[model samples]
Target chain A: MKLTDAKAQFISSWGAFGTHWGINRTMAQIHALLLISPDPITQDDIMEQLSISRGNVNMNTRDLIDWGLVERVLIPGERKEFFTAEKDIWKVATQIIKERKKRELDPMLKLLSQLEQIEGDKKDKDVKQFVDTIAGIRKFGGQADKVLDVMIKADENWFLGSLLKFFK
Target chain B: MKLTDAKAQFISSWGAFGTHWGINRTMAQIHALLLISPDPITQDDIMEQLSISRGNVNMNTRDLIDWGLVERVLIPGERKEFFTAEKDIWKVATQIIKERKKRELDPMLKLLSQLEQIEGDKKDKDVKQFVDTIAGIRKFGGQADKVLDVMIKADENWFLGSLLKFFK
Candidate 1:
């Protein structure tokens, strides 16, 4: 395939993949575009390339920045703002894992902890089942939380290399 | 908290969490209901408890079954079929990982492979960047694929035990 067609395919596929994982389509496409670009791009350039409105480019870029996956860039004499994504895929993956652990897993684990304290007789089947399920999920989530913490803190080489070997 | 209230909270929380991770609300709610129920429940019971339509219950339950997280159970003397979720949290997590690996990750890696072969001069910055991005992603995806494969094939005790120890 030609470079242009290949780039389009990657952007579209990444957008679809992002939607499946709860991120917006346009946002992922923009990220995809930035990931492969050799230089930082302007919002106007993003609008023209992705066929999105200025408002959309503004909103999703802001979100991407908040997620720590993208950044604003200042050109020496340019007026329009430019943006760029973190080109290192390993850092990008770790950043996502860190944010999601904070945003989703931590809070869910908190809720599970609270649910585990529900007042009920342990002998009751309903109570037993509820407690057991909550405890099980809490244990699993705790394990995952620890694992992710290590991943977020460890260097890419040490973590992935150790993990791949351990799995093998 | 009262048992009923606690149950309600758990169902709502689980449904919300599921939506964040790409599962539909109703389906996750139904799965949550089954996970905590000591006995298998019928479609009508799910509808009444979750306040959803029969069609919604039927569709989501079928999907849950397909994902290997829930199963149909035939009672000795009942005309209506019953359903129960795989209550082991580890098993449930592994099943989901397996299904998503098959459905999403596998296809994405395949696309990345084709994109890696895009026709371009290596010296061109755009071409170089694009190829590098695809190659980086492919390598990461390959690692994840292998890790998930190990997790899927592993017994709950052995895998989590080994993983937790390895991480520590």
Candidate 2:
């Protein structure tokens, strides 16, 4: 495929994939564009390239920055702000993992723990099932929490190599 | 909290959580309801409990079955179909991982590989960055695919035990 066509395909696909994972299409497309760009780009550039509005470019870029996947940079001689994505995919993955664990997993685990303490007799089958399911999820989430913690802290090469070797 | 209230809270929260991960709210709510129920429930029961329409329950239940998280069971002499969720949290996690990898990750990795072959000079910065980004994502997705395969086929106790130990 032609370079421009290939680029558009990648951006569109990435946006769709992102929506499946609960990220908005525009934000993901912006991220994809930044990922493949060789240099930082301005909001106007992003809006023009993606055919999105200025307000859209402004908001999604802020969200991306909050997610630690993108950053704002000052141009050497220009007054406009430029944005760039972290090009290292490993860092990108780990950063997302860290943020999600903080946002979702930690709170869910805490709630599960509280729910397990619901007043009930062990002999009641309904109570037993509820407790058992909640406990099982809590345990599994705890294990995942620990695993993700290690992964976030470990170097990508070391972690990936070890995991691949272990699985093989 | 009262048992019924607590159950309601759990179901509501789980549905909200599912939305963040791209699962629909109703589907997640139904799954959560099934997860905690001691007995298999029928379509009418789900509708009454969730305050949803029959059509909504029917569609979401079908999707839940499709995802392998819920199953239809025949009661000893009952005329209606009953549904139950796989309450073993490990099984639930593995099943989801298996299905998502098949649906999303596999296709994405395949596309990335094809994108890597875009005609371009390796020395061009944009070309180099695009190729590198695609390669990195493909490699990561491939590793995840392998790891998920191992997890899916593994016995729950053995897999979690090994992973916890490895992380420790």
- Consecutive 10-residue window with the lowest summed lDDT within model 1 chain B: B159-168
Q: Considering just chain B, what TM-score does every model have?
A: 0.93, 0.92
After superposition, the stretches of candidate 1 with alpha carbons farther than 4 Å from their true spots are A156-168, B156-168
True contacts kept of 2: 0.68
Candidate 1 per-residue lDDT, tens place, A92-144, comes to: 99899999999999999999999999998999999999999999999999999
Interface RMSD of the predictions, in order shown?
Answer: 2.9, 3.0
Judged by whole-model lDDT over C-alpha atoms, candidate 1 comes out at 0.91
DockQ of each: 0.63, 0.58
The C-alpha TM-scores of every prediction are 0.94, 0.94
Q: What residue runs in model 2 are displaced by over 4 Å at the alpha carbon?
A: A156-168, B156-168
* RMSD to native, candidate 2: 2.8
Please, what are the lDDT tens digits per residue for candidate 1 over residues B65-123? 99999999999988999999998888899899999999999999999999999897999
lDDT of 2 by residue, B1-168 (tens): 667877998999999999988899999999999999999999999999999999999999999999999999999889999999998787799889988888888888888988989998989998989988888888877877877877777665676668644432
